[model samples]
Target: MTLDDLTVSLRALRLLAADFGHLPAPDVDVSTVFPERLRLSFHDTSCESLAAFEQWRTALGIAPDAVEARTQSEGRTRVLAAETSFAGAVVMLTAYADQSAADRAGGVR
Candidate 1:
């Protein structure tokens, strides 16, 4: 499916879950979906493995803003994997840095 389709589906999933009193996660640690992917944005970076995150963080002895984990499934099959930064409450991925920056600047939707 297209990215827009994926987003719409995800949003609908969250809303439907919320309707049943199953709210979305307030905080997410991305390290468990795509290990080794160090995503660096303007203010933060993240990885995908909890063990790796802990080891590396211990070595450096610093605090991350947050950590998130997600898993997408279809029946018994896993379909998607990803990671997000730890320092921000909100996140949006854009192909263009300018667009991402603009998105962070204000509510663009």
Candidate 2:
């Protein structure tokens, strides 16, 4: 996806926020889902991996100012959150790493 386009595409920017450090850098698939919607996918979907997407985006020098990120606790779960526009709708992209899934994968908790 074009960085220039991303600067103006708030929806795409928000979706990407939750996927920054979670996905492999410089090697991802981007697709347009509709008139103003986009989709991005990358490697590494493990529940054990934990990282902020904004860090990766900032490091790449392509992060937008529209997305705001923070961490919060839902009962006993820690969820990563990115609030922004998605597909013309205001939404918060939240990702929860499944510690149980990580345990099943032999990953240290």
Candidate 3:
């Protein structure tokens, strides 16, 4: 089993679905464009997104401080990202600002 294995990617996604079932569902990406990785992206306010990202990262056995947090869209959008390997597949978790957050901040809709 390796990151390039489709089976590994699917298995990782299934595990994530089971583990994070209580939280808001993320956008799951398992495209051939990135066959070696699984991308789970969440759109929520900064606080909510950070909380969810922490939970997912911890569940994947990644340290909280290992995350890479930064801002995008000219500092209007906050992005929290982290990557780890699960069951031999690379897993990347990313959370970005939702429309509501941007609207609240008077950003472009």
Candidate 4:
């Protein structure tokens, strides 16, 4: 992430916290591995995570269908993700958890 990218990410986090104060705080990460992207993740059950992602997506004005949902870790983990540009910086909001945990919690598969 560039200096501008970090700046944009911080600004976005601030806004997100202010606007979605009801939700749990996300784990913020900025890495060169993702280049210009800033990743915000929530470690929760699949259902809870998806709900949080949807809330953020809606608040950011992204279309409901503009998301990529997939499974990883040999289908042990379910990942819900959406991307949006904030002040020219790529911001990725993700929610992921172990499928078994969600299953025990009676959450989405």
Best by TM-score: 3
**Model 4: CA > 4 A from native:** 1-5, 32-36, 100-109
What tens-digit string does per-residue lDDT give for candidate 1 at 2-103?
Answer: 444334334433443355333212222223233322231221122223333343333323345333322222222111122343222122211111223333
Q: Model 3, which residues run further than 4 Å from truth? A: 1-5, 98-109
Give me the runs in candidate 2 sitting further than 4 Å from their true place. 1-49, 52-74, 85-92, 98-109
lDDT at position 70, candidate 4: 78
C-alpha root-mean-square deviation, each candidate: 17.3, 9.6, 5.0, 4.0
TM-score of each: 0.19, 0.27, 0.75, 0.70
Poorest lDDT segment (10 consecutive residues) of candidate 4: 100-109
What residue pairs clash in candidate 2, if any at all? Answer: 20-53, 21-53
lDDT of 4 by residue, 1-109 (tens): 3665466556666666777788766788876565556677877754687677777788777787888877787677888888888655687888887687546366544
Which residue pairs collide, candidate 4? none
Per-residue alpha-carbon lDDT of model 3 for 4-104, expressed as tens digits?
Answer: 45777788888877877876677888877667688988887546876777777777788878788777776667788989998778999998874445454
lDDT of 2 by residue, 17-71 (tens): 5555465442333333332433332222443323434444343343465434332
Candidate 1 Cα outliers beyond 4 Å, as residue runs: 1-48, 60-65, 74-109
Any residue pairs clashing in model 3, and if so which?
none
Q: How close is candidate 3 to the true structure, as a TM-score?
A: 0.75
Using lDDT as the yardstick, the better of models 1 and 2 is 2
RMSD of 2: 9.6
Candidate 4's TM-score reads 0.70
lDDT for every model?
Answer: 0.29, 0.41, 0.76, 0.73
